[model samples]
Target: MATTTDPRIAVLSAMAYPPYNETSESRCTPWAEAVKLLADYRAAVLREAADRLDESETLRDLTDDHMHDVNAAANELRRMASEETRPSDG
Candidate 1:
């Protein structure tokens, strides 16, 4: 797999893989942090795609696909964030 130079991306990538603790809070913290980082990264990617699309007619479809992926990531982040803030029965 390709490695990321960005520290945030690196941390998020590490969080994605194994050795997770058995505690709910421990697991949730990394998951939440990864979602937030991914959201931020995707937002940046979306902006870049928009700029590239504006600069050229070619690759428009590719750029649109990237934007769609970014939007999906953003939506997932929003859902996760909302769930994190919701009150628990416990």
Candidate 2:
């Protein structure tokens, strides 16, 4: 459900098609696909967070607790994404 115009998607697209890279066509295809997959996953996380906020009651008494939970989820997602995309030394 991610739109092409999304800034994250735009950044991914730019990364996938870098200028002056001399890699083979076949190799580039898989890399591009992986970037797209990651972008889609990030979008899904954002959507889920929005949905949870939307479903919460306006007069709920657990605002602080809910905010902490949401912040934790966002931090975890950011950590996971960074770890997954980082290049391995071995």
Candidate 3:
């Protein structure tokens, strides 16, 4: 289990990968690295989404909003990924 984890990482693990949040694996994997991996994955997904949008002309109507949401998610994930894995005060 994670005895001293950043809450953001804990919540992310709980929501995206419960096993990490509940098992000793949390200690085995560094939160900063895990979050960075997730952020990178999100960037790849966003790129895929963009390519799909570019290939489908009919979906133009929602392309802007769709990209906005994806970009927002990517930015937020990046912010979280860059945070301290362990609180300095704790």
Q: Over the stretch 1-90, how does candidate 1's per-residue lDDT look in tens digits?
A: 126755456556666653456775354335554555565565555555545545554444566678676566556655554554454453
10 residues in a row with least lDDT, candidate 1 = 81-90
Model 2 regions lying over 4 Å from their true place: 1-62
For model 3, residues 1-90, the per-residue Cα lDDT tens digits are 233334445446545554443565463445665565455455555555555645566655566789676556656654553452323342
lDDT of 2 by residue, 1-90 (tens): 233755466556656664443565332435565565565566566655655654566524567888777667656665665565555443
> lDDT winner among the candidates?
2
lDDT of 3 at 54: 53
1 or 2: which has the higher TM-score? Answer: 2
lDDT of each: 0.54, 0.57, 0.51
Candidate 3 TM-score versus the reference: 0.36
Could you estimate the TM-score for every candidate? 0.35, 0.36, 0.36
Clashing pairs in 1: none
Clashing pairs in 3: none
